[model samples]
Target: MTREESDMIDHRRLGRELDLFVSDPLAGAGLPIWLPAGAAARHAVEEYVRDLERRAGYQHVYSPPLGKRELFALSGHLGYFADDMFPPLRLSADDEFVLRPALCPHQLVYRARGRSYRELPLRIAELGGMYRAERSGVLGGLSRVRAISLNDAHNFCALDQVGEEVREILRLIREAHAALGVRPAGFRLSLRGPGEKYVGDDAQWARAEELLRAALDGVDFTEAPGEAAFYGPKIDIQIVDAAGRESTLSTVQLDFDKPERFDLSYTDASGARRRPVMVHRSLVGSMERLFAYLIEVHQGAFPPWYAPVQLVLLPVDAGQAGAAAELARRAVAAGLRAEVDAGGSLGARIRDAAHRRVPYVGVVGAREAADGSVSLRLRDGRSVAPMPVADALGLVGAVVAARSTDLLPAAA
Candidate 1:
């Protein structure tokens, strides 16, 4: 490789140079390609979030990428999010198809079909690709993208159950963030400005807005009015990056108007039909944006559970190559993402693992080879002390399972 390339290829720069993903103009900008590495990162996050949501009592669902103009008309997306959506494609030269800007509308229809009041609260989650038309010039890295894979969910519940559902969702959001080791920097109660583009009755809007505000009453939040989606008020969860730039990383929005528009209802215990409240949420927002944030935050040193490669075994000599291969096999058997790096100096290989932010680097040199021991070096260069190969593998397995954000805590 050229010296210029080496000098320029730091983590973030290499992330682009290696084609992990790209946001380019020819692709109409703000669109990212999920290259192999990027795809792995995307998959890992999806699996993680899906598992968390499933445990949180959410039922997974998938919907079509494009919804009919009439479907969106019912949800008021045509009136509210028309600017953020792509131009409708003529499906039959008469009818128009709008690339769905959000998943709530379709999910609402799913809820309306033959749902009994017994299903007091239904939480539907989706990890689907959705599109929006961001102007070409505003597109930067993966942080802001046109096409997005969202970890979005919607909760349909009885009016009286709104408060508890909101609290449960917040708990799940906090738990998910903790699991991912992403501590949010700021929280905001996103409300509609008076007489702004906001629709719906003022009293209902106030009640819905108050529900979320009350849920976050004891908690701190930056009050951001006019940022709420036109359909309802919301909570825009923000995170600050290493560069100190703040971005909305997640959201939990409260909706009271759209359900009425769609006439979504459930029979109350008193045998009277009543409208259900809707809650819109996205813990990580889009996979594209989340990946970009993670790359920058960790500087590509992804946690063991999220790292594309968790372990790399380096052989001391050609004779130990077989042992290295065996170690790799064992790692795979243990359900780890591991590989054998047989090139360059032991130090250079270690450096390579460090560069990739691999959680564990295993070294099988002469003494360790004879004793079936392996020297371990963390991405931070701290030695794990040559231990029995089996014990080293166990340690690697534990770290990978824990999904710790930092391999080791910061020194005091």
Candidate 2:
């Protein structure tokens, strides 16, 4: 790649310029502190995904970041994933705890309570924090972090409902990625074979694999033997970023062992107790990694809905500052993120906004302020004709409401 192209896709540099996040040596590696701008963007993403999950009939929940040692032990995490977990904290001889490395165990606990056949295919979701003990050498920007915020969920369903549940999960995955303008290059049908590390008997594993395969019929995916999780088979969504780097961004796994391990069951319509199958899935995977991917893919220029500051009103002189501030207030009231840039000269302020990759910039001078209009400037080097304040607001409001990726819809 050319130097310019290489620099454009460098998330670390762009993150600094955009004031997104920061990592400190004293604070330890792989732990990034999100600045105000970064936090705003993160909030936007979280809200968007939660809305999607809600529409998909998933009930959201908040789980603690730490769990008792016995919880992980019961979930088989200690046996299969202990290497990536932080050391347990011993509060007392009998009360040892460890930071949660995944959300599955806590979710399993939630499902262990009494449930009925009417609640079959119960979907529970959480955008909660998880901790991992990563090697210092592998720590890099947000892509690889010790503290991760996962968009995780689990579906508890009857055996006869597994196929439909998987299909619905896959649909949600596709819709979410499409909304964010991310295209999955392919899928990996991860399975287990000849591995003593896996849980469940051979017949059980074989049945689960067969169910997953049948669910994935008509979908294009590559079979990957031995890539399955210790307890289940999964479909991993592979993403290719603008820099041509490949990463797995989403996953859906079918698990039969965890429910039995936790002794979870629900009463069937026939009045018989039965073990419910569990499906562990992450629609967007790690928020940190997804944010990093977005930064690189869009080159720090986020869409209107996701941009921290959707529009910046630049007052040409101190006399017009009131007008700019009032405009910003109106924009915010209309459900758009807007800011007034009254610092430095007009040229400097414009350049600063451009450098920060703000989607829209409005230059308000005395004449335009008196006329109740704005000279709108888009990120691309194109300027719209001076338009009435109401019209400009309507245009931007439409874009924000639609969550359109197109910055210059007028031009388009």
Count of residue pairs whose backbone atoms collide, per candidate: 0, 0
Report lDDT per candidate. Answer: 0.79, 0.89
Q: What is the C-alpha RMSD of each candidate to the true structure, in Å?
A: 3.9, 1.7
- For model 1, residues 75-148, the per-residue Cα lDDT tens digits are 88888788899999896977889899888777855454766678868888998878878886766677677888
The local lDDT score (0 to 100) that residue 49 gets in candidate 2 is 94
Error of 1 at 177 (Å): 1.7
Model 2 residue 395 lDDT? 85
**lDDT per residue as tens, model 2, 1-412:** 7667866788888889899999998888999999999998889989999999999899998889998999999989998899999999999999999898899988854564689999988999999999999999988899889999999999999999999999989999988886777768898899996758899888988898898899889998999898899998899998866567778899999899988898889998899999999999999989899988888878888887889999999999999999999999999998888999898999999999999888899999999999999989998788888999888988888777777788765544
Worst 10 residues of 2 by lDDT: 403-412
Q: TM-score for each prediction?
A: 0.91, 0.96
Superposed Cα deviation of residue 66, candidate 1 (Å) = 0.7
**Model 2 residue 271 lDDT score:** 92
